[model samples]
Target: MSSQKEKTSPFMAKAIEAALSAKSITSPNPWVGALLEHQGQIINVSSTKKYGAAHAEAQTLQGKHLPEGTLYTTLEPCVAFEGKRTEPCTQIIIKSGIKKVVIGIEDPDPRVKGRGIIQLREAGIEVQIGDGADEITRLLRPYIKHRQTGLPYVIAKFAASIDGKIATKTGASQWITGEKARDTAHHQRAWVDGILIGSGTAISDDPSLTARPKNLSPEQFTQPLRIVLDGSGKLPVNSKILQPTGTIIATSPKSEKNWQDSLTEQGAQIIICEPSQNGSGINLEQLLQVLGSRSILSLWVEGGSQILGSFFSQNLIDELWAFIAPIIIGGDGLSAISTTGTSTLAEVPHLREIVIEKLEQDFLIRGFTGNWAP
Candidate 1:
């Protein structure tokens, strides 16, 4: 009985919930949701399931006859057959007897951008755009970013002390946050397409970096692609990362081929990138482009500070999620980012906090790159 633009609209809330269900499953294509209200009653609610499967609107039409009603979709339905998988969703909606359509946002992708809305309008269907835009945009941020710039959406994650240190000066960093925070981090890892860590982290922590947390069954979890930024291809042969299926070790061209070849034989994909501008590290932009070409839509970087600093320096981080433990280890510990040439307060990196919550003993702070606050 209500349009989708209202802040507290039930239709918008249900659509968002439906979209969230597709997390960890849909990549390359943003998660989408469709809800149909027929005769003042909710008839169908559907979400995009997989990459090549039926889209939300098409799924909603499954086994149901056309009925006069209003349709709500998190994104504008596609009108053109531009994708690799399914047919246009606008045709399905047009074939149905839906009287009105409310959309969250125009597709950031150029192919179906506003043409879907135009097609619906031309077909004598009432169309309302930009309903629940903020929530839907946040939900589709990774896809939107990838469509705009041919690179994966990057999120930098870290767990640090209250004084902003990831580890002590001796590099003894472990158990900074509680179990709940660690579980939360694991869940975050399960949501992204890839997980990245620096060689320093690989050597220091010797972590598996898989999404299998504690009692969670392997069938229930989706392990992200493991990526290591080892500048010289120095990942040890005994490292736990080699045990995984989709493991990539990115290094500079100057790295030794002997160890690289050995690791390649051990199930690691070696990506030899260009040297950095300073010639001390691998080029970060080039690494991102390589991952982008491989269809990595969203990436999370859990770091040992230096790799996180490189991404920060390049302004490549789209979001930052940190768990701040209420402990002080002020004895020359490693700072979150290794001092990025900010001399004055005006030059400090600014971030907008989107979520700050107390998860047991630690505080989880999630923010974006810009200064805008919610």
Candidate 2:
């Protein structure tokens, strides 16, 4: 018998590539891709177009008549359900005369779960599951986490020197990493559903926080939502983040009404969150839930120490990406994470599945926290 990799890896890779083509544009919906094959030859490959548009399976099998063959998808075909915008992909496949269906993983949404697989099998179609499961799971992690926990997958990203300093005592932080790493950072900013920073970073850096990947036109990339954690609403009215249309300022009720109103006039939406139990800032968990309710599947946190500390202390961070440069700023400089609430080495949080990649003069250290994967 042929091994599973020999049978499904190539097709699944193609499907995943197709899915990534639309990943940035599909939010609140998983980026899915499908490939239709006849005999040993491939017929067509398609991916999700946009939010609320036709899914990958439907896009692949619709309006096409082909010989009985196999269908490979990065995600389980969705079944018909209430509130779904389009026809169920299972029905479409059954009518398309496809003989076999190979799926990457089951849909995590409660509405679909394993129902799509059952629907296919009941129609007398051969079904194969778990091909390319690991890769597909990583690709759909944000969507899976959102559906499973009603919380966006949180990723904390920062750049620091070899000695673990983010900036000097004077707060100058420009050009910490090389050009290649900075380019990669911009690409990451474009990939997530939202990009977040604390008010301190906003006031000190005065960053626009826009994703401008090198050589890519604005039309080619969708700008992720800009979010700021400002419990006191102390963000300056002239801050660049406030100029964006999709900016959200998470503040506490104690914030000044005039400051909130001024930011509102500048196209920023103010979300009032309860103060943390320690009375230090707004509740991070509550803010995450609010983002999840708004269909934010992934959140990228670019910090200025205090915000990173809050997230790490609350154990709200799922993944971390640290870009380490070759230079050292010594102990007097600001650290990447202000506090981790650990008094001993044993108490420090550990990362799993660590991956390190060299980018010019910088090294990117990435890992998942707790039981989180990918």
Candidate 3:
């Protein structure tokens, strides 16, 4: 008999392709795809739907009665666990009369981990793993990061001049990049679960922080949640971000109650975070934990130096997107990133797998930080 790996390879590719179709639509839950095959013929293919809905396997097998077949899934089928919102996919697959199962990767979630595979095996179902694990891992990076670290996958984005300055000495930073780069940035904003900025950016830019890509209609994409890191609660109550219902203000315990209440009155949620050990700002890790608990799997950080520096200092950033304009700003201009306390070249975070793209006259440089892959 041929190895199970060989039998599963062809189906895993189709399964991964199906999963990619649901990208950016499923948050908190990993976007998974399922395919059912019988006698070398494709039966059905399904991908995950919206959050809090049926999983890929359940969607594919539910309400169907068929002969024994092989089921290919991008992720391990989930078993019933406490606090689970939906029915377990493992049970659904067993009931659907699937005799063999092919999984791309085991879920990193502690709740299900290897238990789902064990359950299938106990039911006398043939299980095989691998083939498209790397692709699935890349697609589920945010979800896996959240499950393992209790922190959202962070992507830092910024626009700077050729001289690496974000703003002129006078703090004029309106149109650093061309319209094409800005539009691409908006599309990225729509892909993430949240958009974050420090208080300095909040005060200086006063941006609306909404994802409004010109090519996408309002109904086609939902606006990401806006988050402001205001340790001292200095963000003005009238800031454009505060006008949105999904805005969150992360403040330190020292913040004024009146200011927090005023922000709350504006329909923004206020989360009290512990102060950092350096006494500079609210604890970023703690704030990330809160975001993870709330099911924010991915976050985009549009910074004003300090926030970018903080995330770099803590090694929290997974990816970096830098848009460099052709113009040059003088030495007196503000730098794109503040001091990160790196005294040596080796201490500086080096990005890998660098990719460059041209957005009209501007150039976009994208890379992964640390051990991040994709």
Candidate 4:
């Protein structure tokens, strides 16, 4: 039984894996549940549901005799009480005769930041942390981000034709990629905390912004933050996006009224960009910095041609996921990007590296920076 498990404190690792599976349980509070075992015997198990629900530690201590100095749990013990309950998780662990604590992911909420570990250490509890919690932690990031940033991971999404046109000559471009590619796009949304698009695209297309093809589980799509980039501030106040999860307006500093407080009142976050070039949209680098400072660890730039081109020219892309539609449109409309300025393969910014994956039709090209264009 001992050799059957794998990777760092097998009991804790397995418990973390089990706890991480609750990523979809967002509504009714984050359900952080775990099981404890020592010397191949089930000692106890527990979970946290809603605010007043029995704490994971409380349930863990249910009807059991624990061995002294035995390690317990992957979630930090709670200290702060919400509503009418005041049972701190620290006191419970100490009372249970459990001499050690093992946490999976650090509590991301700043209010309770580091308090769990501090209390456990002060009480002379031997603390051990699980190693493989990152994967599960990342999966739970969607829920954590909502509590902290008031906004989700703002990923920009777009699809362009061979020549970079989002639409054709008459401007009627519906389905450009195959079913497989389109399906993949929706799945990609699961990784992002939110979806962002320009007001122009929103007004022009009126996309629902929900994960498409309907592959995601119900819990996955229910909480993504939706954003709209409207530099001129032309979006309707009662827009559809504003009705549901509401819309985050990416406005410039010029729109002083378009700051965070106002947007927050309207269930939105006002993102201030660094002004658009030629009085158009804001610079992508500055835009990303603003989002990154807000703790948007990862982002996806949905393209419309000019937007993708700007990032390409500036070489700000850390990773790229390009979907080549099976069929190519030889049109005089828009191109993926105009590739402005003068340059050949030699003149453009040289990519240090790239990995190419051949899909059913198009190629998925991922590129890296800092290298010369040789």
Q: Cα miss at 85, model 3 (Å)?
A: 2.6
lDDT of 3 by residue, 1-374 (tens): 11133333788889889898776677778889999887898788999887888898987776667647788999999998888999899988888777889898888899999999999999989998875777677778888888887778999999999999998998889999999999999998987899999998899889999988887876555578999999998988889888757599999989999999999999999999999989998899899899988989899999988888888877788999999999999879988888646678886777886999999999999988964443
How high is the CA lDDT of each candidate model?
A: 0.84, 0.88, 0.86, 0.58
Preferred candidate (lDDT higher): 2 or 3: 2
lDDT of 3 at 68: 73
Q: What is the C-alpha RMSD of each candidate to the true structure, in Å?
A: 3.1, 2.7, 3.4, 7.3
Q: Give each model a TM-score.
A: 0.93, 0.95, 0.90, 0.62
- The pairs that clash in candidate 4 are 156-302, 157-302, 158-302, 163-335, 164-334, 164-335, 164-336, 165-334, 276-281
TM-score of 4: 0.62
- How many collisions between residues are there in candidate 2? 0
Q: In candidate 2, which residue pairs clash?
A: none
- Residue range with the least summed lDDT across 10 consecutive positions in model 1: 1-10
In TM-score terms, candidate 1 sits at 0.93
- How does residue 350 of candidate 3 score in lDDT? 76
Looking at model 3, the pairs that clash are none
> What 10-residue stretch in candidate 2 is worst by lDDT?
1-10
lDDT of 1 by residue, 223-303 (tens): 789999888767798899888655999998788989988888888999999988977679999999999989888899998
Tens-place lDDT per residue, model 2, 325-345, is 999899689899988457799
List model 4 lDDT by residue over 280-369, tens digit each: 676555665566555454455665566666666665554456666656566666566544756566776543346666656655555544
Q: What range of 10 consecutive residues in model 4 has the weakest lDDT sum?
A: 1-10
RMSD of 3: 3.4
